[model samples]
Target: MADRKFALGTFNAGIAPFPGIVIDDTVYDARQVVPHLTVATLLADWEASLPALTAAAARPVGGGISLSGLRVLPPVTPPGQLFAAGANYRQHVIQMAVAHKLGAEGADPEQLAAAAAAEIDERKKHGEPYVWSGIPSSISGAYDDVILPGGWDDHDWELELGVVIGRRARHVPVADALDYVAGYTICNDLTTRSLVPRKDIPMMGTDWMRAKNFPTFFPTGPFLVPATFVPDPLNLRIQLRLNGETMQDSNTGDMIFGPAELISYISRFAELRPGDMVITGSPPGNGSHWGRYLQPGDVMECEIDGLGVQRTRCIAEAD
Candidate 1:
């Protein structure tokens, strides 16, 4: 019982349990504790330390801090580094191209009307690629609030399936790439649409870091379901909601660039270490499509088939 693979975290009532390294009653953050173990020293080792982790975790943690009373922290506090794919979905790419074209020319009344009609017609066709960078310092654990940054009047939610690396993969072959994955987790790549314009080239251009990377921008976790649990990461279902209203609804099968290809491509440039996370892009149904965006006090929820659902609320920036 002390040397077996087990998922840790406070599981009771409404509190979302983050899969972590449970050492007695004190659950050291999973990402933090993994570094203490040298083998693989990355997400791929999510299962390698089973024997030692189970034994250490079984030891009774002194003090009266029961599991239920603990507030879950981000599973992997520092993921070496974080990067995200943009417009990886076939449908999302098409939508982005149309948006960019419409935004390019539509200043006049005649142009605005034509652009509107073109946009509607384009919706029937596929879109193109659009990229943006996410803020890594703003990452948070599941069940945490995503505080919308100041100057951002319209925030948005993007439901994405995050990939956790399992080993030191550098230019690994796509066929064997999936083997390097440790597991999967849910990530809400919250964005400020009004701030991150899809325009081509403006006088000042665009800065996605400020628009997408605010504190708590990447709300992740609930659990890192082992890869064994997800034989085919591309077949799972993904869904998102705002205050219970379904926003993003789709499946991994819709991804144009699959996980293996993405991992291999990224590793070509950087030596992806343990705990490094890659948000594999989001599906359609973003607030930008609608006239409104995330308002303070709105609750956002993201769910994947194997990975447990992640729920967070929006808050105003502090004065």
Candidate 2:
């Protein structure tokens, strides 16, 4: 068996990459590092470029950004808007159902009932499928802090496998969807459950972006592992640790919808561009269950099979 290929943050000690593109405190031009290529383009060009990407992996290039010098940015620059699904996993949906039944204390009973009724109506209208959160501010590099904004006492971490679109896909068939993937990386869809004032805010309507997409809400990878390396995306393990203690541990197999299906399902309405990202749902272990929340100086680590680990520390914004 041959070795696999991966991309790293190559940066300089005195220079930075670019605005919004941060690596280990130093920034670099993403346009230069990430070839203006999509997943489909890479696959088509694989036969020829494979050797070069492989050679780089085998031999270290001098004067290049060392892993220590460059911080791992989210593998791809976020798209204009990002869409995420809610209760997409059967187990997660069931858990939320129970939590909703417990009811939110201090909320008006009649209003809560009305909200529940509305949710039932929407369920009849759309079945189990729902999408929400056009998160623009949530775009941040993988190593960036998963900020715990004040007032968010129920901050949580979700271990997810993120997929990057490599082509312009709209209404693509599931059978051909995998062809549009550029690669896969590890993502921590950090969220704050306290933002939803009432249980009535349907999972989709909770502005999950506010909880999930803080400035550095979505911390992603060390680097992207080309799709070719992931023969079975569903088989990968997804694990997360808080302050060096294992908090969540599960496999991608637990996802309600596989990557190919998610890509195809999302493409039906919106066009998935070369750099757009979709975070497949997370596994069971999250901070909420342990009654823990992110505090200043907290550290989080997320790792997925094939893709290496991404480590980040939570810090307050510079005054």
Provide C-alpha RMSD values for all models, in order. Answer: 6.7, 6.7
lDDT of 2 by residue, 244-299 (tens): 99987878876666778778888888887765667788776667666687888889
TM-score versus the correct structure, for each prediction = 0.75, 0.75
* TM-score computed on alpha carbons, candidate 1: 0.75
Error of 1 at 137 (Å): 1.5
lDDT of 1 at 290: 59
Top candidate on lDDT is 1
Q: What ranges in model 2 sit over 4 Å off?
A: 1-4, 8-13, 18-65, 78-80, 99-128, 134-136, 197-205, 317-319
Best by TM-score: 2
